[model samples]
Target: MPEAHGTDEVSDARPGPIRVVIADDHALYRQGMAIVVELDGAAVVVGQAGNGGEVVDLCARLHPDVVLMDVRMPVVGGIEATSRLHAADPRIRILMLTMSDDESDLFEAIKAGASGYLLKDLPGEEVADAIRRVHDGQAIIPPGMAATLLQEFSRLSQAGSVPEGPEPTTLTDREVEVLRHVARGMVNREVADALGIAENTVKNHVRSILEKLHLHSRVEAAVYAHQQRLVPPDA
Candidate 1:
């Protein structure tokens, strides 16, 4: 049986333990994830589902803060489940936790409104950390996965004809500089010092970049930039 924590009623609560629903076809993996979330005192696995249909139903009933979803399932896959959940409530954040790091899976999940895409191979601690980050409205993508995502984006852009119209808003000069450093895999502090700016200022710019692009995280922004050929593929 799943453990239950006290449900406190506080409006200003410190974003109470991130409530999560784990959805995976494998029962063992589902239980493993549940254990990980519970181990982290700040996260709670409120429910579990084995298929896409169950995922959608649980989302409406439980309203979990995060969904640790799998890429493929029996009735419905993670991509379709994520879409259904997001359509029902755009505020719900979905995180794809899968074993496959396929570029197509990553792209489809992102387009379906996934706030984070992480591999199941990640340590339980890392998984917990990612859950918190996504709960805080940040997107998470593992290192190297960004490269695959960018490569796929480039292929799509090259194949399709560009539409003649106003382009999506571009990042500001300063924002571009920050993103350039980010694409190089520099952390926030490194970016701040390198750019001779405060860390908080760098963070603000990052937030702005995400908003402008309708992206969820720095990783996504970096990949998007690469897709647009904003930064050299080799660089």
Candidate 2:
């Protein structure tokens, strides 16, 4: 199962509270989670679900901005649900909220299409912050997990599983700079600040990068950046 954790802050340049849906088999826990999300004031709960199927139904119906999903549920599991939801709507962010910290779960969650994974024991404040960060297009991986993820990417690269994308020549000089920061796990605002550009400009660059590269989320862009050596491996 997934749980909550922290990510870098997003630029407040984006307006409005992020829309969310909470999914968990336990009614009380689900309700409590809804309360926490609402109390945080950064997100509004648009729906709730008790299983993976219900989550897909709610997401299709409501088109929420994010889904706070738990991994363990009857009928379907969070990983499957996340994969389904992501395939259906890549724009909808999915954050896994469960108690499992097993590396295998983490690896599967990423493969299953989760934008981020968190332990259920994450602090309420950090959870709220992570919602905003994920909504703002940042990939949320715990500090320690990042190394493991990177190592996995290396293994995949060695196995020749990573796709050979467009040549780096396709990106503008500015976009290359932005990708460097993004691959470093910097939020849009951070990229903007690093490149001394406006936040919206950074967003534009990100969009262009995704379009030119045919990638979906910032997480994919980050991984692609590494695999393509857009940024130095040691960095």
Top lDDT model = 2
TM-score of 2: 0.80
* Native-referenced Cα lDDT, model 2: 0.79
How many clashing pairs does model 2 include?
A: 6
lDDT of model 2 at position 199: 89
Worst 10-residue lDDT window for candidate 2 reads 5-14
TM per candidate comes to 0.81, 0.80
lDDT of 1: 0.73
- Residue-level lDDT of model 1, residues 75-187, one tens digit each, is 89889999999889777778887766554688778768777687788777778877776776666776556667656655665666321222335678898888777766677
Stretches of candidate 2 exceeding 4 Å from the true structure: 1-17, 100-102, 184-204, 231-233
